[model samples]
Each structure stands twice: as structure tokens, then as C-alpha cells.
Target: MAALIMVDEPSVQGGRRVSVFRRGREEHLGTAFSDHDVIVFLQAAGLSDPEEVLDDPRWVEWSGGRDWKRPPMR
Candidate 1:
């Protein structure tokens, strides 16, 4: 039942999505994208610190995790 509430905010389909975070009565929503777009932009702006991720070339996203480690590629 609680999980259903999280899916209320529909994703941008093949684009960015606005998702809400739950914390008591304090709910905060943010954008969720399906690409490495933010990574490049953030990196170019010097905001994506930890050059490891910015230079790895293998990690091409803001997901802050490994690509191969993704869940079932689903």
C-alpha cells in the first residue's frame, strides 16, 4: 500500500521524471532522468566532483553506481 504512493508521480517516459521522497511529513520531489545527460553537464560545470566517475568513461551517468551492476538490465 505504501509503495503504491511512490509510483503516483509518473516518469517522463523516455525523459526526465519528478519523484517524491518520503520522510515523515516532509516530502521532497526531484527530477529523475534516463540518461548520462546530467553527468556531462554536471561534470563540465565542475559540480560532478570525484574525477573517478567523470573520467572513468565506463561510468556515464549520474546514477552514482556501476552500469554492469544494474538490475537485470530491465
Candidate 2:
């Protein structure tokens, strides 16, 4: 079976960022500051066609929805 990736909700504590994790793993793969960063992270993790990976539910599970745009500062 293909590896499952999880994109967590965006956090604004120290600027807007999203955490990427492998399902069932304790440690995260990395934090992404932008949508591009997420693609890069996935590429580094050996996933080809990052765009398709992001869209496919079988590969990625987006928490709190997939909002690539960074939220406005408070």
C-alpha cells in the first residue's frame, strides 16, 4: 500500500505554518510555510507528482481542510 501523508491544520503561533506527518508516525516529516513548501517536502519524501498527491484522498488527508493560502495576521 502507498504511504499515507497527513497535512495538519495551519497554526499561527509563530507565523502561519502547516505540519506534515506520515500517518501513524509520532514525528512530523516537516513544517511547510507555503503550498510550494508542501510540494517540496513531499518530493523529498519520494512522492512524485506532488500536485496529484495533494488532491488525492488516498495519498493525503488534509485536516481542517486544504487551505493553501496563509491566514491573515490577527
Candidate 3:
């Protein structure tokens, strides 16, 4: 594992903030508010099939801790 991380913060627009970190360093993975956004982020992170990573139990557990609000698909 490359120490990939995801975190959520309160956004100014009442939406949520989703950040990605790797190797304990913050990565500017961009604004992720939906599954698609996360998938894109994952792809950029190196995974070809984002859903596979999303479906992983380890990722599921980590994502649960973020408490990020998933927005509707755009």
C-alpha cells in the first residue's frame, strides 16, 4: 500500500470536502463530491478501475471514517 488516504471537511457552500493523501502527504486530488468524482480521483491515483478500489473492504472502512457527504451524480 502507498498509504493512500481520503478525508472530508466542511465546505463553504454547504457541500462536503474530499481530500486525498498519499504517503502521509496531502495530494491535490481535486473536489470529490460524488462517486464519479471519487472514481476520477482513484484513477488519477493509479487505479484503472476505480470501482474495484471503491468496493474493497479496506477502502470501505477508511471511507466510513471520512463522513463525507456524497453528492448526486452530475
Candidate 4:
């Protein structure tokens, strides 16, 4: 799975935007790209500290499970 998360896009007035995908292909969540939604999604996904995700590229992949639980991506 792949996820592209954007926080405060455009400007501070903007919200978060997330795109979910599977096998390098988008899953098509069927909605406009909303902003500021990443906080909720991350919490529900059992993850905190959005900075960690932003700081690392590996967090971009969803290996059918929690990527954080795995070793650091290289």
C-alpha cells in the first residue's frame, strides 16, 4: 500500500490530504482531497507523531499492516 499525506497544503488555511493505494495503485477513496484529515486518520491507524512519518519515507508504504512495527526502511 502507498499513502501520500500532505499537511497544511496551499496554506495554513488548508487541511490535510491523504491518498490510499494498494500495490502501487491508488484505491480511489471516492472524495475530494480534503485537508487536515490526516490527524484523525493517523490516530485511527494507531499512530502518533506525524513528524516521524514526515521525516521518513518508509512510512509511505502500507505493507498490509503497520509499517512502523517493521525495521527502518533503507
Per residue, candidate 4 scores C-alpha lDDT tens digits across 1-74 of 33454222222222223544445664433222232344456555456775467445555533232222222345
Candidate 4 has its poorest 10 consecutive residues by lDDT at 62-71
lDDT of 4 at 8: 26
Order of the predicted models by TM-score, top scorer first: 2, 3, 4, 1
RMSD vs true structure, all candidates: 10.6, 3.5, 5.1, 12.5
Give model 1's TM-score versus the native structure: 0.24
Question: lDDT of all predictions, in order shown?
Answer: 0.33, 0.67, 0.57, 0.40
Return the candidate ranking by lDDT, descending.
2, 3, 4, 1
Runs of candidate 2 exceeding 4 Å displacement = 1-3, 14-27, 69-74
**Candidate 3 C-alpha lDDT tens digits along 1-74:** 53354535535442434455656676666766666777777787787776876546455334344445544445
Number of the top TM-score candidate: 2
Give per-model TM-scores. 0.24, 0.68, 0.54, 0.32
lDDT of 2 at 9: 73
lDDT of 1 by residue, 1-74 (tens): 23201212223343333222235542323333433543444444344453344334333322334222222334
TM-score of candidate 4 against the unseen true structure = 0.32
- Please report the candidate that would top lDDT against the real structure: 2
Looking at model 1, residue 59 earns an lDDT score of 36
